[model samples]
Target: MQNTPENDHEQDAAPSKTRRKKDMHALQEIGEQLVELDPKKLNEFDLPEILLDAIHLARPMTKHGARRRQMQYIGRLMREVDMRPIQEKLDSWQQVSVHQTARLHQLERWRERLLTDEHALTEFAEKYPVADLQHLRLLIRNAHKEKAAEKPPKSFRLLFQALQATITEV
Candidate 1:
């Protein structure tokens, strides 16, 4: 007999995806609620919470628009977030960050020790690299003068395709 949808689903057609389906159903309900909510009801919710939740529930935006929008957000939030409490949190964060940085820096010095000691790399990568991990932070100071205004670099795939075209000509 030709199998029906019910029979196919029942015969362990791949491991069950019920959890994923449930999550999608819950998200659909949330999206329907957003469309259904009155502006006044949305306004009654905490402004920041509402903004964050609405953005989270919205469909993904185009990549270029999303990055520009995030930069705009950081600029706006930088102005509005309470400075002193934010500074205090940042200060604590800085201290923890510095401590972690120093610890990593010291461990990086010991990488050779890892090969000799056997447990060194395992313990380090598992916990934290014993090395300074200063990420490449950026700032476009005097952007108009420097002509270094910030934007994301082009996609690697595009770069590779361009390189391939240049290389293949006889």
Candidate 2:
């Protein structure tokens, strides 16, 4: 057959081998992430029974080669499944976790500042007007004493929990 524009266009319509490989790898990575999910969370995804069985089989695998083969099989099965919802759910969970982590860091900074800087308590009261300044002050004092005595950080934990409550309320 002669090389024609129509034939060339038809050929170009298919994805390149490199692109196809990348897609398969991406799906495989998604499968790996799915396998790491909690069993309850995994059930939230309407995955195929075969794929679920494959994932279950992979969970107890101790050997490298067997798990690798199972993962590859899961990837192949993923090709037939609509991956959009699964990807979206994973993305949402990641975003929530990131936000929660950021919030925890912010609270930790506040707690450290409260412990080290006397002025930080006033600043915190100013920022979170609803905060019980007296209770916070007492907790800070106890936390200092606990640290000095090298005791368990009961007050320290209480301060964090208090901060968590105050910040969350805001």
Question: Taking the tens digit of each residue's C-alpha lDDT, what string does model 1 give over 1-170?
Answer: 78998888877656458865564454444333433455654453343664445444443445866644543443343343344453454456569979878765554444334324646435544454332222100111122223334434332223223323322331
Quote each prediction's TM-score: 0.29, 0.97
Candidate 2 lDDT over 1-170, as tens digits, reads: 98999999988999999999999999989999999998999999999999999999898888999988888999999999998999999999999999999999999999999999989998999999999888999999999999999999999999999999999898
Q: Clash number for every model?
A: 7, 0
Clashing pairs in 2: none
Quality of model 1 by C-alpha lDDT: 0.43
